[model samples]
Target: MHWGYTSIGASTYKGFDVSYTDLIGTFGINFNLFNNDVVRYYSGFRLGLIWRETTPFPAVGGALGFDIKLSKFYSKIQFYLGMRLWTDYREDQKNHFYGDSSGYKRGLITNNALLQENGAIVLSMSW
Candidate 1:
């Protein structure tokens, strides 16, 4: 079990600059390549609750990265880049544009359909 967090000073969302934060939690595995044990690679799926001006929604995706074993204040450090697709992202964002609407415009998913209209690039660090 692992927990994470992130903060963005500025970012581009649909061509506009935005700022936000996230609280993340993940479960996955780490494997040591060639059994060297010095360098380990890891991949996992993640789910984050995005906190932004518009609304809070879940962004879920996977990540791939590695762990470097360093002898210092932080013995193990990880750098990962991930893509999180929002479950409530509308294709046109018209709902956010028009205050509110019915049906899918209001972030609804129907009959086995996944709301995958939006996504986010995630860069994070952990020790």
Candidate 2:
């Protein structure tokens, strides 16, 4: 289980800037494919919730990575690197309009789903 936070800023098609933050919590299990005194390889699945702009959405993803022992005497300290991919689903309640040349005046509300992918590089000490 882990908790993570991310802040994103981007420009929209209308040339406006917007920013938002996401709070995420995940619970999953990992299976070790290979292990030794210096390094270990593993893969896992994740099911979690993502809270953005005070709204909660569901997220599901998986990870594949390895951990390298960083301390010779303390095996609990390690460096981790991984690749993760997930899908986030949410409802779009705001107005969305086409370009002025399209002659579309009314806005549309629809459901939106986003695919989020990221990599993690971390140094951790476990008790």
Predicted model with the maximum TM-score: 2
Expressed as tens digits, the lDDT of each residue in 35-126 for candidate 1 is: 66545556656665665566675656555555454433544665555554434322333454334544433234333223444455656555
lDDT of 2 by residue, 1-127 (tens): 2222222223223332322334444444444444354554445555555443455455555555555656677454445444344433322212222223233222233223233445667554444
lDDT of each prediction vs. the true structure? 0.48, 0.42
TM-scores, each model vs. reference: 0.44, 0.50
Model 1, which residues run further than 4 Å from truth? Answer: 1-18, 72-127
Residue 93 accuracy (lDDT) in model 2: 16
Clashing pairs in 2: none
lDDT of 2 at 34: 46
**Native-vs-model 2 lDDT?**
0.42
